[model samples]
Target: MMTNTQTSSSTERIAAEAPLIERLRAGDDGAFAELVSTHTGRMLVVARRVTGSEADAEDAVQEAFISAFKNIEQFDGRSTLGTWLHRIVVNAALMKRRRKRSRPETSIEQLLPQFDDGFHREKPQSIEVVTNGGGGSIVEREAVMAALDELPDEFREVIVLRDVEGLDSKSAAESLGISDSLVRQRLHRGRQALMKLLERRMKGIES
Candidate 1:
């Protein structure tokens, strides 16, 4: 019997790679369009999570596609094209951020976490509040998005990749060029951080 975790991991792995494998390998034009349609939104979301700016995310995604097309020949069927494209996008986004940080090296230090410890472990309390009608009708869906904006970029990126983009730990780790264990740790810590942020925001509102 497949454990729930194994089933989820298998399902995500299959979903993430199957389309690119089919369309790109077969040289099907419609497959390319299908690929774009299937991944563009989530790619943008991941890009935005990494770059922390929609404009940068847009640029990163465009550049990633360009890179992916150029590198398609290098793609072995060993991994999905979506995974390949995601790595390209992340590199592009990181390069853009590095360019932006050129003037102030301090920003790099500020952005990256100092330690691997899961310092931010608990999720924002807002989820409970939101579930319990704490905000009632006042907080719109956009507010939740904005709350995500409040998280540190790294935390947001891991969470968005794992929870929002629906990437498994392996693919997410591969995309980020990190270990799978690290991806799992980040995802756990990221969820905790977001939950903590939400809780704090909710308390502030009620007070």
Candidate 2:
């Protein structure tokens, strides 16, 4: 759920973007350039996460921008333009993934914490996947991305949408065509798997 302040800020941003959206709908080339320049990098990041390759991600972002341009008039003021574009990019990436044959994925169940008959972890270990980084270091960011990339597609998608992209459970569920309960379950298991991967990476780096 969005806080009052977040809702107000989003509303203000949408209001501010009204003129730009109008220009886009009017097919103003300069306005389109501005939109592309402002959002391409962020959109590429989302695409890369979803498609898992630079070339495919770039294609996905390009397709998303073209689609967004074609449908600019249909965009209601319910969400900011950036948010709308983000959704388009994600959809494009998902479509690209469906078109391409994906590599074999690792089983997330192997990474999840196992429990015995008493509901106790058979081999308990602390798993902490830092979603919000206190240290904004490039190395830390890369580490997080690396760990995220190791997860299976389903698990990775859930974590990226919820933890990295800041989507609520309901929103993520809607985006992925999954239930709210499944989103929560995937998020929990994904974070645990990610934490284990990150810890191993950090230890390897230290060694």
For all candidates in order, the CA lDDT equals 0.66, 0.81
Query: Model 2 compared with the native: what TM-score?
Result: 0.78
User: For model 2, how does the per-residue alpha-carbon lDDT over 1-207 read when each residue is reduced to its tens digit?
Assistant: 222324568878889999998888888999999999999998998899888789999999999999998888899978888788888998899889768846666678777766777585665443333323324467677888888877887888899888887888987886788899999999999998887777666555431
lDDT of 1 by residue, 51-123 (tens): 7689999999988887876777678756555567777887788777656643322122233333448674433
Lowest lDDT 10-residue stretch of candidate 1? 104-113
TM-score of every candidate relative to the true structure:
0.62, 0.78
Worst 10 residues of 2 by lDDT: 125-134
Task: Give me the runs in candidate 1 sitting further than 4 Å from their true place.
Answer: 1-38, 97-127, 134-143, 205-207
Per-residue lDDT value at 102 in model 1:
32
lDDT accuracy of residue 41 in candidate 1? 84
